[model samples]
Target: MRIVVAHNRYREAQPSGENTIVDAEMAQLTAAGVEVLPFIRSSDEIPTMPTTAKALLPISPIYAPRAQQELSRLLTEHRPDVLHLHNPYPLLSPWVVRTAHRHGVPVVQTVHNYRQVCSSGLYFRDGMICQDCRGRALGVPAIVHRCYRGSRAQSALMATTLAVHRGTWKSVDRFIALTTAVADHLRDYGIPDERIVVKPNAVPDPGPPAPLGDGFLFMGRLTPEKGLDLLLEAWRRHPVGALGPLRVAGDGELRPMVEAAAAERPDVSYLGQLDRAGVRAAIEASAVVLATSTWHDVLPTVIIEALASGRPVLGTALGGIPYLVGAGTPREPAGTGPASVASAVRGDGAATLPVGVVAGEAGWVVSPDPAALAAALPVARTGAAALAPAARARYERTFHPDVVTKQLIDIYADAARTAPRH
Candidate 1:
């Protein structure tokens, strides 16, 4: 099968799960004997773009004429069976959908975030989940709050881009949602159930399960939304060495916060930003992986990585975490903790259901609250060892590259068949 995999990559200085996933997917497809024609743009080029190119950046999101012309020529020449789109922002633009359609090529897009409406793609602002523009015709709230890169002008441009591309997005042949939460978001955005497919991102399996390690590991971009602060608060709530040792990794806006936390307590150790080898090593040395995103993170790849490594996860009940953790089963069969509580209360005074037995194999899920998360840490610590096999099994069945890639190939074939033949 011939497929055009197009994406706009984030800057290299920052770690982007979307970028990593795109690369992995391309490699996986190639290994599976599919011919992948990559059409990629990087944000790092913005700084080095020619003067004229820089001037056109403001309107690129709405329509990148040069990108369209190039893609048009490519489509006309290659005529790939399907054009699978990933991130299309300031460089590629959603015009690729129109371009592919014009060439009679089917277009399949992977929904990476909430960028269809929210300017920042996070649906979060000012340490709170914000979706003020969900059902609106235009994302005026995004412009007002400067949700895109913290620039009012940029946010306005992004909002305009979202407004202009509503039809462009709807016209897509198929939507690959990385998580059920993302699929639900697409439904809420007016996409029909038939057009949307739930396909979670996959990571390379880290071979066989390693021996369970000590303490816990929270690895990702150390940002506020990623739940670094909440993890620290929960860690601090417990006495030192109570829940083994907490090792923090990754670099972001909250590096100082992580450093301070590590300094304040001997149990908390910040490992700084790690390379792939270091990450693997860290995961091998940890028991439970913490994916505590405070926002609606569509699919934080870290959670999948943990599963691949045979490590259980203790993640926030928000976004894709609960879904990733398989929260329906009771860890205790009839208990939330040792006492088997029927329900747990959140910091917001709302009652939430328990996730499996205390050591449900896939770890636990709790509210994003410090208190709720703090209370569950020890339970997870106690249960991490037993959860290894199930965690690895979940990865193989759901997120292993072989499984996800075949599903994607099928989606591509379906999209090609259903599309208007050239």
Candidate 2:
């Protein structure tokens, strides 16, 4: 099958998991013998654009005439069977859906976030989960609160673009929801069950996973929503050197908090921002990986990375973390001692959620709190060895390119059947 994949990449300095996933998926398709065409744009180009292009940048979110013209030429020349879209923001607008429809091409979009209704696409603002603009036609609340990149003007533009493209998004032939939580979000947005498919992103298999490592690694942006503070508070509850070591990475608004924690505790160390190789090295050296986001994070790639490397994840029970960690599956544990599913018991003797360090299980999914995470830490450390195989097994079954790419190909075939027969 011939497929055209389009995406507007986020800036490189910050890095975007979506960009990484898109590239990985395209490579997976090519390896599987499918013809793939990538149409991509980068936010890094905004700084050195020609005067004419820069002049049209402000309105590009609503309708990028240049993108439409270029896409039209590509589609008309190729006549591809399907058009799959990832992120379409400042340069590649949602109008690309209309362009695909005009060319009689079925459009399949991977819904990455809550952008359809919320201007920020995060449903979070000012360090809190805010959905004030959910039912509004214009999302005036977003503009008032300066939610999009802390600029009222930019928020207004994004909000207006969302309001105008309501039909364009809904009219998509298929929506690839990254997680069950994302699928639920699409349903709440009025997408029918048949039009939405649950397809998680896949990572490359890193060959045989090394033996379980020591300590725990928390990588990603050190922001309020990423829950770096909560992790630290829990770490402080334990005495120094009591629960192995904790390594924190990434830079964000909460860097001071992370640095302070590292300075105050010998067990805690800050590794700053990591390149892909550095991240892999850290994962290999860690017994468990952390995904402690306070917001409704759709999917944190770090959890999957740890799984692929045979490291169990200690994730918060929010958004797709539970699903990513293989929770709610009706499979029995592997063996005795750390192999059984563990319930995080509070210091006060209260029990919280369970950690599945079992046969098909990945790890623990605790409540989004310091206490729950604190209770789960020792359990995760104890079960790291038994959980290592389970983590690797889960990666091979679900997030491996050998598995998810076939599901994607089937989705493309279904989408192609829905294209207009003009």
Candidate 3:
């Protein structure tokens, strides 16, 4: 089957998980001999014109017109069976959806983040979750707070896109949510429940678990929402002997802070930036993967990569992480009820500790607190080795490219078959 994938890349230098997922899916399809075409755009392509021109640009949404015209020509020429979308926010607005509808192609969009409702796209402001716009008319509180572009005008443009297109629900044929929690969030934003489908991002299997070293690892952008500050605080709270060295991967605005912390604390090591292979190597070598983000993150690919590498995760109990981690464990007995006093105590021969168990099985979940993190550090360090087999098994079964590729293809075929026939 022929398919066309469209995505507008993020402006940040760091590659996003959504980009990775799209690339992986395309590769999988091509490997299987399917005709896969990519219609790509980047935020960098947007000319850095004067403030006045830039401000007015959002009105006609020039990016949308250009993308729609380009896509129309492509669709008319190739006539792909399906048009799959990842991100079309600022650079390629709802105009792409309109183009697909006009050409009689099924449009399947993946909700990578909360950008559809929030101008910031993170549901975050002032280093915390801000849902002022959720379940309400598009709010400019984020703009007033200088959420996007740090300018009221630009933020308003972003807010306006959501406000104007709020009623364009019929344009999209299906919405691919990365998690059930993400689907629920979209449903709250008035997206029809029947149109939303849950499809978690998957990663390639990294073979068997390798021998892990003693250091803990941090992978992801060095940003406020990533909870790097909290990670630093937790490290400080731990006694010197109890804390292993921390190796941070990836770069962002918080690079200076990370550099300063690394300089001040001998245990913290900043690895700057690394490519995909480098990231996989780091995950394979580390004891535990640290996902201490303060904001609600929809299923992060790093977590899946870590698990695939047979590395355990110490993530904050927020959003869909608990659910993702739950896939690794065996079901608890039906009548096991709540934990008893004996089960709660660590030394009472209990098969599992309730505090760390997620979905009655997977890796540990600590409160988004420094003290809790400090306490859990030892447990993570100690259990990291033992957890390898189960983690690897989970990756082979769920995230292996062959397994995930088929699921993605099935979705594409279904959308293609059900697309409106012109």
- Give me the candidate number with maximum lDDT: 1
lDDT of 3 by residue, 1-422 (tens): 88898888776586587778788878877987889989987777567755754564566432466667889999999998888888886666777877877888888888888877888888889978898877657676877887877889878887877777776544577888888889988888777877787877777666767787666899888889888998888788776646678889889899999999889888888987898778877886688888888777888888888888888787777676665565222222345422211123333254344442332134666556665566567767877777766667766776678887787788887777775653
lDDT of the candidates, in the order given: 0.86, 0.85, 0.74
Query: Where is model 1 more than 4 Å wrong at Cα?
Result: 329-361
TM per candidate: 0.93, 0.92, 0.89
Clashing pairs in 2: none
Clashing pairs in 1: 329-356, 330-356, 330-357, 331-356, 331-357, 332-356, 332-357, 335-340
Superposed Cα deviation of residue 239, candidate 2 (Å): 0.9
Identify the runs in model 3 with alpha carbons over 4 angstroms from their true place: 47-57, 60-63, 327-360, 419-422
For candidate 3, report its TM-score. 0.89
Better of 1 and 2 by lDDT: 1
